[model samples]
Target: MMEPAVCGEPTEPAAPPPLLAQLRAWLAAWLTDERTARELVDYGRVGHYTLALTRWVAIIGQLFTVLFVHFSIGIALPLVPLLAAIAASALVNLVLLWVLGWRARLSERAAAGMFVFDLAQLALLLGLTGGIQNPFVVLLLVPVGIAAGLLGRTFTATVTALGLLVASLLAADPLPLPWFTGGLVFPELYRFAAWAALSTAILLIAVYTYQFAEEARHRAEALAATRLALAREQELAALGGQAAAAAHMLGSPLGTIAVVAKELVNALPADHPLREEANEILDQVHRCREILKTLGPRRAGSEVDRLVRAPLSATLRDIADEFGRAGISTEVRVDSPDGTPEPCLALPPDIRHAIANLVDNAIQFATSRVDILVSSSHERLLVAIRDDGPGFSPDILDWIGEPYLSTRHDRGGLGLGIFIANTLLARTGGKLHFGNTGRGAEVRIEWPAGALERAVEEREHDGGHD
Candidate 1:
């Protein structure tokens, strides 16, 4: 016997590399793309939040500074200058909050301005205190850290560099640490360590936040695409019963018209001019009757209960024609066992939508041509879609048909197209298989004879309650 076709044959795409290797590759790609490296988050309300947080921090910091000065512990900080800086920052933040209340979103420039002002206040506070030797000096980076996570690289880098500059300057003449008695002195090594720690923290936090934010955005978009596809499938399924009812109702009225025309032809005199018109009406009635006969009886089989109960081959052709209109070349072929009737494949709306999605995907990926094959044998039905283009990438080959696993992100693909298609087909007792030819991608869908028709009927029956 001939062997069954394995998914990744010699002609197929190669397997993906190790997970660590793949991670490194994606990380490199993301870092090189400035937009991707920048955090993707809505900063609409962040300004208001930042201003509020700063106001509270300033108020508390001022209160502490006043109490420390009264005790005259550490080298007495210039208490008046420190209090003035805190008051200035508080006034600025209050004004910002009032302005933001009427605005929907903060402009990047405006947000950056506020952060710069905060950084300036932090530097002044450090200058009055113990500079880098003061434990609170680390707080100088707070505004810059927030900016790095929400702004572009140019802005983030600028803020970070500015913060480091201020810290370096303050390190030269910072007052001694506060104490109940004499001020404490810091060693040179501790000063260097503090500077290094702050710099490292800023860079690492920016990169980590950017990577995670990008991932979250991508996932949300993919889920949305999946929901859209499933919703369209449900809509098509809902129309199935209505289509069947219309076809069934028209059959009886057409038959009555045919009977009336035939009676008129017999009653008219052969020599009368009206006789020929009656004959024409009778002839047209016969044509309609012949068409209605194919629709079958309303109560015959579960397959006939849907409006979209066309043979599988016809449905495929229609889908192909739709793509042909879009300028894509499509070829459709069908193979059936000898003595097997045509129109053997039954398609409800859901199945039809699923097939269309598969066809659309093939056309999109194909370089110049797409081939659709329908066949039946030994009580089984099958459909195969082939495209003449570069096949699936090795990294994503095994992940095909999985949600959020798209290789066409640049094309606005959410990676849910194949997943949605597979899910819809599964509901109708069909299985979707993916593979790669040396030249391109291939998909195969299979079902047992009469299986899909029954599944569709059951789905419709269940849907009636809600």
Candidate 2:
């Protein structure tokens, strides 16, 4: 049975939920409810409002071309009822902009609504100006293209479909063009423009959304890395506090036990077997007191950098011991090829957590045995974990450590274990490699000894300032 816990062993807490999961949940919520849609956009960016301003300019430019400039261009223009309708709609849009104000950012819903209104206004312009016969009808796609870049897929898709429907409807019935005397006809070219407008909306929306979403994903990944690093630092900070508290609280009980054991030794007869047991108890209590005394001041320090650093061998042993307590068949060994003494290494929370995660993964997949081997020289330090079980499948080998990509889904693997491990180790100047030993699976971690030492020092220096 696993014991409650032993003092001095570093505990690896569960990783925070993957950010990808949070993103997926938000996307689902936004797609279902208009209220939920308002939070998905980063309206703080100036570009969000710029798109709307550009739409206004385009609408105003189109109105000027039909109402005033057509006569100069020798296009036989005449103002119709559609011109009045377009002017009134444009006026409403201008008033809406004035109410929204330039300083305030539009919510996601309002932004989407703005694009929808642009589509409606453009559709009306197309019907009046000659429907598909007007070359500028292709401009109806502008709203959907903007939606693709600034809004979620559901909203973009809605706009794209609406644009397509408007194109189709315009092909069937369009009011007479004011520029034409009797109603000019260009059958073949108009038919082509209708098909072109529909196709262009779909294609441009796909291209723009894909480009923008990919950029957003990259930013999210960078933010996630910074978050993971901060979490490791906080966990270490918490551990130091807990360790000091444990030592402080246990000091008195251990003193009383030492006193009791000494008295018992004095009371027992010299020949009695119980005397030796009492003496052993006194010795143990004395050892415990010495340990507490040493731990007291180090643990008392407020900074994580001041916590006691262990040799690599001890760190591995602590991890193995914790797993061994859980009834897993685990062995830890330090191999010195040059027969030199192993270097004492600082066990920062990030390194400890990474190693422990790999060990846990090995235990889960192993049939019987898992071995953690540490070997180092003047140049390099290496830790290799091997397990006797089926190795990673070929399909997932290249994609290992990617979030949400797991082989053991049935066993509740979220596939984030390897990713967290790999990320943390990378920060410490370590490289993680995975492969099969023909018999099972193996993961090897290596670091240049000098680079790792410097990384540890830099981390301490930075953390101390924090």
Highest TM-score model number: 1
| C-alpha positional error of residue 226 in candidate 1 after TM-score superposition, expressed in Å | 3.8
Q: 256 in model 1: Cα distance from truth in Å? A: 14
What's the C-alpha lDDT at position 69 in model 2? 46
Model 2, range 1-466, lDDT digits (tens) per residue? 7556678987768677788666645543443344545533452243334855786687678778775646666565546655775676667566554444444455567667767877888787677777777777768767777677776666667777887778877777665554536566567666766667567766776567756674575456645765876687788777756765788899889989988999999899999989999999999988887776554434223343334666677888788667653445888889878775565657667778778888878888888888888888777888899988898887778878776567799999866677878888898889988888987899999988666667776665554341
Candidate 2 weakest lDDT stretch, 10 residues: 297-306
Can you give the TM-score per candidate against the true fold? Answer: 0.61, 0.58
RMSD (Cα, Å) for all candidates, in order, is 18.2, 14.4
* Ten-residue region with minimum lDDT total, candidate 1: 36-45
lDDT of model 2, residue 350: 73
Can you tell me which runs of candidate 2 are displaced by over 4 Å? 1-35, 38-52, 69-71, 74-81, 84-107, 168-182, 187-190, 193-201, 224-307, 311-343, 353-380, 384-424, 434-444, 449-454, 457-466
- List lDDT for all candidates, in order: 0.69, 0.71
